[model samples]
Target: MVIQHGGRPEELRAAREECAEELGGEPTAPLADDAELSKFYDLQVEAYECLVANGYSPAPPSTREAFVASYYAGESWFAHQPAVPEGAPIPDTVCPQPMLADIEW
Candidate 1:
């Protein structure tokens, strides 16, 4: 199925979900541990810093503890939230969404 879809992300995700349903497993992978979460948070902070360096006025980030707590509570947390001014689009070239590759991990 992935090959049929040319390995597109949506296809890959759908495949995963289908497999999970059939195998009675989670449809999505969970974060490995707190270390991984910290790395993700660090990358987000770094991205916000990049935006600032490029003269974007992003709101300050919450403390790491708060971030972790929020994440565990299933609340969305993003550094770019409200940092972008209305009517001024932020380009992906400035700071694309952070993935595993975006962190030192």
Candidate 2:
């Protein structure tokens, strides 16, 4: 869960706690850079593909927001075990707020 700066810290913390309860684990702190973020997306995509290959036919929502909503509802690919483990520790060198121009995409 990438928490953008829309809410107060306490609100964000509460939301994170609620999400952890729903998802069955706490989310890692936001990824430090586009590289890490890309890696995260890649891992998720890989997991989704693996689940599909294994006959887990998750119906991903058409829109990103819908996907996220489904995820929070425990009705998305996130509900299944991934082929790879989630939440490997990120190094400190990756900045929390990386400049978009510096990222390779």
**Cα lDDT computed for each candidate against the true fold:** 0.72, 0.46
Q: How accurate is candidate 1 locally (lDDT)?
A: 0.72
What count of clashes does model 1 give? 0
User: What TM value does model 2 have?
Assistant: 0.30
User: What 10-residue stretch in candidate 2 is worst by lDDT?
Assistant: 91-100
lDDT of each residue in 1-105, candidate 2, tens digit only: 554646889888877887788789854665344444344344455545555665554333234444444543555343143334563332223212123234444
| lDDT of each residue in 39-74, candidate 1, tens digit only | 888888888888888877766788887777788676
Query: Over all chains combined, what TM-score does candidate 1 have?
Result: 0.60
Model 2 residue 21 distance off true place after TM-score fit, in angstroms: 26
| TM-score for all models, in order of appearance | 0.60, 0.30
